[model samples]
Target chain A: MTVNIISISQITSYLRELLENDVMLSDIWVLGEVSNLKRASSGHYYFTLKDDAAALDVAMWRTYTSRLTHNLQNGDAVLAHGRVSIYEPSGRLQFYVDMLQPAGVGLLHARFEELKQRLAAEGLFDESRKRPLPPLPHRIGIATSAQAAALRDILTVLARRYPLVEVVLSPCLVQGERAPDSISAALYRLYAQDVDLIILARGGGSIEDLWCFNEEIVARTVFASPVPVITGVGHETDTTIVDYVADVRAATPSAAAEQAVPDMAVLAEAVTVLRQQLDEAMSAQLWMHQNALHSATATLQRQNPALWLARSRQQVDDLVQRATRQVRYLTERRQLQLDGLRQQLITLSPYATLHRGYAVVQRTSDGGVVTAPAQVQRGERLRLTLRAGELAAVAAPPAPIEEQHTDD
Target chain B: MTETSTETYETLYTRLQETVAQLEVGNLPLAEALALYEQGVQLAAACQRLLDSAELRVQQLQSDQPDDQ
Candidate 1:
């Protein structure tokens, strides 16, 4: 009845309002196979939702497209939830997707598994290829977005745990289409550095946000890194392909930092233990040597040469005293005997007889005994001997004898 | 064992260990034993000094970059 010359815009605007006002169409769920999928450079997603029976047009703006967990492709069965709306200008009816999910099993998950199996079959995730991390790494290379909170967390933990480690930040994008190449480049850059280890890290995110780490190129690059790579790409629940290919896997960025370096407190404690061991070992050794020295000193004192010499000197002195006493006694005894003999001789001497008033005459010529007075010559000289003096007389020996007798 | 002050912590610790082992044998002559003991003491002291004086050091690498894949 409104065929009363109504314009096409008015009719389309009226239809758009009618379609938007329908509560069932305003918010609804549609099950279909995706077709004609296209991503505009402006980040919008355009596609057709179709089944064996019917078809529908779909459009997801950039904000909603960015939230998609899986990449849409032709003939992917999905459950799309959004509103039906009409464009007045083009007079087109379309479904604006707010949320999209795989119809039964997620196709992206299947692709992830597919890629994982293929890579695993190719030996990219071989355990034998994994390398041991350096015990004390001096240089640690980090591949992460500089603006990410994950980087801040890693830096904070590293500074707290091991400030001695040199940190080389190889910045890259952590998500979106360019993330794979950016991450691969960052890993390659780190591999060229003189680093002992590498840490590829990212904060927790949705599956799509974490998709870069699951990329085959990122995984292969991490697998081929010269230095051992440690991956901390998401929360504990998120596992990426790079995580499997890396030498080590950590649950969080802070955990990666923990694995990359040693704690200073622990090392300090080790040094302290070593010092204690040294002290105990040295003290025990010194005590052992001291005990040995004491025993040696005791043995030396037992055979002391000074003590032996002193004992020998005392023995020599005692022998000298005995010999001196024996010599003195013998000399005294002989002197006494000699003195007695001299007394006897003195008592029997002729001089003693003269003292007792006896006299004898002798020949002056030969001093023969004057027993025979007639043998004396008148001119011969004779001598009289006394204890104190000697006298000489000639020819008058008789008178001299008389005078000697009188004097005696 | 190095007696120079520039000895590293690892080197100093290793020498201190060796000195301790030598002293533990205890069969050297008196003068030699005393000298070794003195050296061991110094080594232990030097190890302590090395640990004490060492401060954590950090640096950044430069000059190498790879093309984006």
Candidate 2:
């Protein structure tokens, strides 16, 4: 065999090509414990992934490094996914890692738990810190990916339930490395908008795909949002840190929309009920006043002075007629009695003897019945009484009366 | 019947509720009660109009770009 002399560059170049071309090694995952992790000022990440039997050097460029959900540290068992390649100048083989995650327990999950605990301890996830959602929100702000199916679902649900709500969408990246910042910034934008409530929603996805809402920045932003925040991340089973911090949590993006708006049919039913109540109240009030007015009318009739005066006038007229009849009867009886007594007196009077042509002499000094001669005076003037008139005569009656009395 | 856009559905609903309460207390004069009833009816009609006239409106903020569907 002829020995071919090759320069070191040629050898390194050949090795680089050999490792770069292998389909399996080009994209592979290595499970190991991390060690000697370093971040350069250039934003590149250098780390070692090792197992008991072997070790691998890993280098992730700044662009991919910034996308890491969890920080890499020594002794963290991880699965690094990337291509295996050689640095020709250093003559060392390394893994150019694009993604790194904890193997036994996901690094992202561990970070999520750690953050959840920290925020919980800080009272960011306290139930008391949660705000009550508006019962009927007129304006709603949505922080989500504009192109996401979740957005479409939310819009559809809102339109179906209550279309009065005006939606302000603050679109952001809902996945990948830049998602956390993008979501946080979107929340800030929505916060400034004049909206009654906010819905931070995303469709169902794997934990890694939905990791942005699990970030501390997103959690804090949701907590500090001026308008109440309703979160619907991933699925019902996938609860995020922001969900704990948000004012309300829904099972799905459509559910978040339901929470943010009131149902029109239900509201209409309520209004109808209220209208009935108002009608009843108005009628009741009117009925009460009508009863009062009726009683007042009855009382006025009972106490009417005009009617009482007419009754009193009738009573006075009856009394006057009765008294006048009694007085007239009494006067007639007295006049009849007086006339009979006067006739009796005329029948018994001595004037009847004078009217029968019997003359009597009487003393003028005293008028006395000459029944007894002893009662007559010798020259006394006497008067004979008659019913019509009285006559005066001188009396020789003493001699005559004496003769008559002697005979009796 | 007035411009529905000027007032929010929430405000109109709240006012209607208050008017209902006032009517429910049942002590107002007939004229006042009638006036309140008229107002309540108007509010309910306005609310219905608002609900009937509303359309789902979606607006996108320009600061952040959304990803491809």
Candidate 3:
């Protein structure tokens, strides 16, 4: 074989290609103690990851560094994930880290804890910061994936519980690296729409799958929301940073929806109860007024002039009847008395003596009656009233009667 | 019966409650009480109508562009 001369640039390029082409080197995790860590002004991080037997140079660009939950320090054991490559300028092997976390613990868990502590210290998770939800929200904004099962569950619950509310869906990706920004954007859209309340929800997932909700951007977005937010992420066990910052936390998407709106059934029952109360109150009022009217009518009748006139007329009629009765009784008594007087007069009359055969005599000419024989006149005419018949006699007859009596 | 459509359910319900309360106070004139009763009945009917005819409306918000921040 002929010996070929290669320049330094050519050799470095060859080494870079060889290292980058390796499957294991392209994607890997390295557990080592950190040393010689420095953050440059460009916001990039330069560090050396070393083990007991070997050491490797590592580089984290600004994009990845800005996402770090905790800063790396010298002698800190860390697990870093990236691709291994050769730096052609210096002909050195380097690892480009996209993710870094404390060793021995789960990567996402470490980041989650770190973010939780920092945000908690900033008072973002304080109870005082939580807002009260509207008792009757007219419009509700939902931030979730359009195709997510969480969306379906939430809609189902909302429809069943409160069909009067208007639902505005601001769809976004619920998972992967760009999900945090997507969720933030969705929240912004809902805010501009002036929704009464917001529900941020996602279906059950693993920690890695639900990691976007735990991102700093998503957490900040939730904390900064103008209206109260209800968060339901993953299963009941999954607690994301957004959950801690939300006004209300629910176990599932359905629960979130349940918290966001009032139940129409309960409200309808309340309305019915109010209506019943209104009916009862109105009836009572009417009854009272009717009673008043009845009493007033009675009072009016009592004071009426027509009734007074009727009573006076009755009294006058009674008095007139008594006077007429008295007059008739007195007249009858007087008539009876007069009749008795007349009967007495008749009994005492001389006409009865005449009827009993005694007679009164008068002279034919002088008309003087002779009580005895000494006073007899010859011819006097006289009228007599008798019970039956009357007889006339002269004075001579009277003298003769006395002489006859003497002879007997 | 004379209620405007602009009134919300909450407003109508609240008015109904207030009317009932006033009627329950029991000191108003007959004409005033009758008027209140009429208003209360109308409010109740309106509330019931809303509950009966209400349907949920759902809408989607389309973002102007994909968020890359």
Best by TM-score: 2
Tens-place lDDT digits, model 2, residues A1-408 = 999999999988899899999999997767888889898999998888889889888899998889887877889988777899898879899899987777854556557766998999999988887788888886789988888899999999999899887888888888999888888888898888888999999999988888888888898889889989999888889998889999999989988988888888998898888778878888888898899899999999989999999999999999999999999999999999999999999978877767787765445565446666677655566786654566876545445667899999
lDDT of each candidate versus the true structure = 0.79, 0.84, 0.87
On the 0 to 100 scale, the lDDT of residue A72 in model 2 is 76
Q: Which candidate number maximizes lDDT?
A: 3
- Candidate 3 lands at a TM-score of 0.57
**Per-residue alpha-carbon lDDT of candidate 3 for residues A90-169, written as tens digits (9 for 90 to 100):** 88889999988878554666678779999999999999988999998878999999888899999999888887778899
| RMSD to the hidden true structure, all candidates | 24.3, 19.3, 22.0
TM-score of candidate 1 relative to the true fold? 0.53
Q: What is the CA-based DockQ of model 2? A: 0.43
TM-score, one value per model? 0.53, 0.60, 0.57
Least accurate 10 contiguous residues by lDDT in model 2 chain A: A360-369
**Runs off by more than 4 Å, candidate 2:** A1-105, A310-408, B1-4, B64-69
Native-structure RMSD, model 2: 19.3
- Using lDDT as the yardstick, the better of models 1 and 2 is 2
Error of 2 at A106 (Å): 2.1
Better of 2 and 3 by lDDT: 3
Q: Residue A364 of model 3: what lDDT?
A: 55
Q: DockQ for all models, in order?
A: 0.13, 0.43, 0.37
Give the poorly placed runs of model 3, Cα more than 4 Å off: A1-105, A301-408, B1-6, B66-69
